[model samples]
Target: MMRGGSNVSDAQLQQILSDVPRIINDPKTADVLVKRAEELGQKLVTERLRMAQARDIFDELRQIESIWLREPERALRRLHLLRPKLAYRRARVRELGPLAEVLERAVAEVVSAGDAAQRHDRFRRLMEFMEAIVAYHKFYGGGD
Candidate 1:
């Protein structure tokens, strides 16, 4: 049973699974499916972050920063993956000027730090950058 009181029976679930090949064969439907999957992934990440304690968030952010420090290109690619969701959230919360400013600055710092040669400095900047993101989500509910 799902939150809306709709129960997905096994037969329906099996039917959907049986249609997988057809779904993949149709380009338009496949594209829609992929987009929906991405949105779901973003929602899951947001919910996890929202439910996490500050210490847990900090630890995860540090791990991400460490990855960035060690392999900047990979980190940049990972950050790029997050761009769409971050942009959406920013647009939704544009009225929060100060928070938006901080987020913008942090994003810029992260991008710039990717090119920086000093690992220690880059790590610190990356931590600050992620902290800003965490702060935004904490203060304001993650945007729809």
Candidate 2:
């Protein structure tokens, strides 16, 4: 009494239906499902770790913005605009070698500046370098 377009035989379908409960109760199946669940849980943990690292980077960027920009609203706005790119950068930091070098140089320049004008200029360059890092991260995947 199988319907048209059905590939399964009636006896096969009946056997499968009859085996369903036994399959569900099988210890081997339960072990496989538990292993899969553990794998998924590990993936979730790894993802959370990446997100946390990204958040920490964003926090550092916010601090830099506040120190250099001085305007709360403007700093907040800029951080909001750059948040996604920053997240991407944090996740792929290892891949962004040149960008990381640029950032380090810019930070060094900012730290070494002796006067207000020089500090401001260096900070501006640092911000630009950071933006470049995010851009690079967006286009390229992380390193090994």
Candidate 3:
């Protein structure tokens, strides 16, 4: 979740926003960057399915809790350790460098529109495009 109040950083937000499109356009890059992020995602789904099947055979919430719920400390430590890895991922993406200036010109045209509704629609479409990037990144590892 995004942080609330004035502490929010524009750099971070822009990074997030900037990422939306590239991720959609590339999935292999994401996979390579994220240490089997795609494989892990599939593994997660498979584990969930296995748990559901196990639930049918055994009604033991306590067992499930023991297996999954006790890992918060480990998860936190992993997050800390993974921070550098994630940073490298972001850096690698940036190394590919800036979007073509033409895209910026297109955006400027939308931004310059006098109609607020038109501007809103333009931004919304941009967001959708970005979301596709995210989805692509999350799964296919930047095929392009």
Highest-scoring model, TM-score: 2
List residue ranges in candidate 3 displaced over 4 A: 1-106, 142-144
lDDT of 3: 0.33
How do the candidates rank by lDDT, highest first? 1, 2, 3
Best by lDDT: 1
User: Which candidate do you rate higher for TM-score, 1 or 2?
Assistant: 2
> CA lDDT of each candidate?
0.42, 0.40, 0.33
Give each model's clash number. 0, 0, 8
Runs in model 1 lying further than 4 Å from the true structure:
1-63, 92-97, 129-144
- Candidate 3 lDDT over residue span 44-79, tens digit each: 232222323222212222232233335633423432
User: Which lDDT tens digits does candidate 1 get at residues 28-100?
Assistant: 4544333322332233334443324333435644665668757876766655544454556556544332233
Model 2, global lDDT = 0.40
Q: Write the per-residue lDDT of candidate 2 for residues 18-119, one digit (tens) a residue.
A: 432322233234443333223322322323323344335536775757655466445444434444554466457652322222233334445455665555
Better of 1 and 3 by lDDT: 1
TM-score of each: 0.36, 0.37, 0.29
Q: What is the lDDT of residue 48 in candidate 3?
A: 28
* RMSD value for candidate 2: 22.9
What TM-score would you give candidate 3 relative to the actual structure?
Answer: 0.29
What are the runs in model 2 whose C-alpha is more than 4 Å off?
A: 1-55, 69-102, 142-144
